[model samples]
Target chain A: MSQKQEPRRKPGRPKAGTDQPDARDAILDQAEFCFAAAGFAGASLRDIATRAGVNQALLRYYFGSKQDLFDAVFRRRGGMISGRRHVLLDRALAEAEPTVETLVRAYLRPQWEMKQSGPGGAAFIALQARVHAEPEAHALDLRREVYDPSLKRYIDALSGLLPAIPRDLVATRMAFLVGAYLFMLNDLGRLADLSEGQIREIPPDDMLEQLVRFLSAGLLAPAI
Target chain B: MSQKQEPRRKPGRPKAGTDQPDARDAILDQAEFCFAAAGFAGASLRDIATRAGVNQALLRYYFGSKQDLFDAVFRRRGGMISGRRHVLLDRALAEAEPTVETLVRAYLRPQWEMKQSGPGGAAFIALQARVHAEPEAHALDLRREVYDPSLKRYIDALSGLLPAIPRDLVATRMAFLVGAYLFMLNDLGRLADLSEGQIREIPPDDMLEQLVRFLSAGLLAPAI
Candidate 1:
């Protein structure tokens, strides 16, 4: 191997500010698909490299390792989604009285907007769903750092809104809300077979409306 | 290789019967874990064989191919769960004036029972969630055959109960219900991290009760 191709660099510091913006985006895009489809353990750097049309060395030059690449792919999209959610939640909390419906909309509306953010947005949603559903904490460190804070805020906001509901119940409902939203938005198309043609016919906004409606009801429901 | 070890078999058919029940069960159990963790494309027979404490050839000898083995693992638990769901729904239908609570309980109670059906049961729930969330039709054939029938039954029953709710809305709610239930039942512990000890305290029965209560509300909530 030539020294030019495989330049030894410090670990954890990928060559920053790429001259070729598309190259970096291309690598991340392919990595997103791979990691979404196969997962962190299942996805291989070689496959991602080949798909991105970059050599393995170049791939590592851009991203230190597979784990780092996975983190990069996660962060590229996670920052956008979580950042938007934080803003929405902040706006809702500033209101004098934030109802569960408003909070639910704040938490869920970004997912609908993400559906319009093109393939990268959808891929990120799928990747998030996979990582969220993962049993092992493969992506736990990043998740805790990047996303959990926003979730905690929402959980706290909802807990205060529904004092009649137990605090634990708020957290549980939040988990359920996220679980249902991610599943519905990410793999909701798979339900086409189940719905014959009905699920496919509903517009994205309508789908989000129904999801918000369902989640709000569950959140506001009285304990038996 | 000796005839006993390297038995030439057809691609689709493994040996008719297994002399060792434990080995087969062990193989299915390990396969369930690997497939759930890594997915079909990501999981390898070698890893499964190693985990099962069996040789790769012996593993193939029993299950034909990795796909066949995946199918076996899926069917082993899926059939039981779907079958029990069918029976429960049947019993609920037989009851006089089966309320939404009755139907919801019938649909969800089995999942709690499944939690006690050993590791295989838990693994199956995770596997089902993985397969359900998967967008690709990797194992769509089996899923369609095993799951859609019971889901249709539940949807129809729910539609009847909520005559005011649109049929398509019932389908959407069913999707959300399954998504939430599967996530809650399968990886509910993952939330303990998010809840920071609050979610950890809820007893399993209370958890199920909360789930049932939440789902019942969502199912019965008036469409806006």
Candidate 2:
């Protein structure tokens, strides 16, 4: 997790004098871990700085406040996840005959891939789940800025595909989908306990396929 | 949010000399509010004590520890929710021809009703969501004790209803259903933001019906 060593500087330390991108990334990485492990209020900035191997001043220099640091951690991966979703959504929509399954897959695949990306990816997934559980005042702005656009696009596509359902109902179910995906993303071992060792670990592909199938059926359910 | 007044005691205060159930209930109430707002680690024992109009000693006397208090708060409502689910489930099973929708409604209705019960109900919903997002060590035991039995019953019932699907897959989908319900229970205002006021507040009955439709379809989807 440390960058290359520099002459006259310790390992995990960026250049002391100027603001370096490596230092910024390190802080975000550690911040993500801390926030994922503990929530926003529970996570300590000083601890994040220590884990990142930078001083508190450097953390402040890079990110103004604890809230700013939290936002930065979210924005870094939140943007990437949303961007990938858009790319996948565009590709799916461009298909010769886009089905609800294809669109659902497109919406879910990016997050599935992100969870599989690496430790950083996994940490971000946990952090994102925590953000959803966070109080509205703390999470609302970041969610609106980062996730709402791509989510709206998916909601629109799903509505178009299921014309029988009211658009508002579609929107509500989309929220349900978001909830299911986020919960499944980091189930916190509930699945294992609930299944009682009957289902230990599902292969990533199968899990994604299962989710798409379930949600597609859900989206196409006859409107009430 | 306070109990009845007592002679020579403050309004929020309980009988000081004894371990009154009222004092215990008050502690749990305030603890639920604090934990819901600030999370387990971030919630201060001091604040909870002050809010409940008892000293820290009384909290420790009744609950023994902070973790104990958290568990008690969860168990208080978790047992009620799970017990109500069982009653509904049993009723559905007793029906002459219970459909997938009926079973789904049975499982979800308790939680929906709990969310509407009052402020305490709302706070428990929030706390439950936070518990799912909490670190596993902190939440796992409480969840297993309070929720797993009813969840397992639902999984078995669903598997019996959809015999072609793998039992494990049914369990997985049940987890998905749980995720969707918890998320929609207190969506952290996501639906409002996503719908952009096209849908303001969904009437409770409509919301439950919509959830039943979505989840029933999701659960009955063909096994992958």
Candidate 3:
């Protein structure tokens, strides 16, 4: 219940300065793995502590319970996530008349260049996938806190291209894009085999252009 | 473990007809709901049986165990699912050339028009959403058995139109479309309040035309 935010905390070690992923980092790592596997209720502090090579006493010393550890994990990473979504859209939209390709690339590039391709990409993707399916309050808090600011820019850019479509329909189409983005980011392993690695080589610009065209057409299609 | 498929029984109901949803049907419904809410191990047969207004014995009688019941639910719905996807796509593609709009409609129409629409569509959606997130043997079985056939058709059609881009890229775009379809069908219950009723009101032909034009432009767009 009593959780503290360590937002301004230094990136490296604590006061004593220990090495490794860090006790805090290690705990989050195992929690991500556990939550991804056993889910929220099914995972235990002992399991996490065991996985992290730490004692249960140290876990409680830092974060009161399993959920406190979870809260810390969400709060710390949530900004990076929203930031990824925000930067992509904002950078693309900054153009005088950002083409659909620029816009699509803007949306996807941040994820790929950062989390999706980096060391922790798979775990982050798994966490995102887990949140979508389960929707913990911690994750929802971050989603509500950050989604609009990050995504509204994309909606505006898309609206600019399709003036004929009603504002609400534009919003609906945006919603469609968001859903698809979640699938692409989360289904890495399945998609790895599914698409045969074209996602890897194709330039983000071209991929994005095709995405916008496909989505714009599909969303505008009549509901049969 | 002796889970028989009711091999000797006649189709529909017995001549001495039963009024209930049937033991097997009840178990499936309850299992789907419970699985949707809590997932596999998180859900219990006693809970499912209680939810179905039947005894636990009935569930065991029809499906042997929880795993058996889970497999049976997916197994029963498997054909209807894959068949609907193929039929929808086939109808949409039968024309000399197909537009993205028609393709989108055909892709989505089957899930919308099922006879079982009155029940918990959201629950089923949520369940599938959860299963797809983690993906074990159960999720894989359904994906291959229920999804791959139609997915191939969609990919083949898209590949024909955009031959320059890699075939895998086309499939990823298709995956994006599927993501949107799944989200709309499952969530997005607030569409009416959002003034998104236009999605439901437009004629199917007009809708398809708009979608195809929008998709075609972007898919073929060399602007990137």
Q: Which stretches of candidate 1 lie over 4 Å from their true place?
A: A1-19, A196-200, B1-19, B196-199
Candidates sorted by lDDT, descending order? 2, 1, 3
- Whichever of 2 and 3 has more lDDT, that candidate is 2
For this target, which candidate reaches the highest lDDT against the unseen true structure? 2
Off by over 4 Å in 2: A1-21, A188-190, B1-21, B188-190
Cα lDDT tens digits for candidate 3, A59-140: 8888887777766665566667668877667666676887655665566555555454654555666666566565334555
Over the stretch B147-197, how does candidate 1's per-residue lDDT look in tens digits?
889888998998888999877778888889887888888667677877765
Docking quality tier of model 2: medium
Error of 1 at B137 (Å): 1.8
Any runs in candidate 3 off by more than 4 Å, and if so which? Answer: A1-21, A57-61, A64-68, A87-97, A117-119, A135-142, A160-162, A192-224, B1-21, B57-61, B93-98, B135-138, B157-166, B190-224
Cα displacement (angstroms), candidate 3, residue A33, comes to 2.1
Per-residue CA lDDT of model 3 for B50-113, tens digit only, reads: 8887777778877797787876766555556668878877777788887755676676665565
After aligning candidate 2 to the native by TM-score, how far in Å is the CA of A45 from where it should be?
1.7
Q: What is the TM-score of each candidate against the true structure?
A: 0.88, 0.90, 0.75
Q: For model 1, what is the error of residue A2's alpha carbon versus the real structure, in angstroms, after optimal superposition?
A: 26
TM-score, chain A only, candidate 2, equals: 0.88
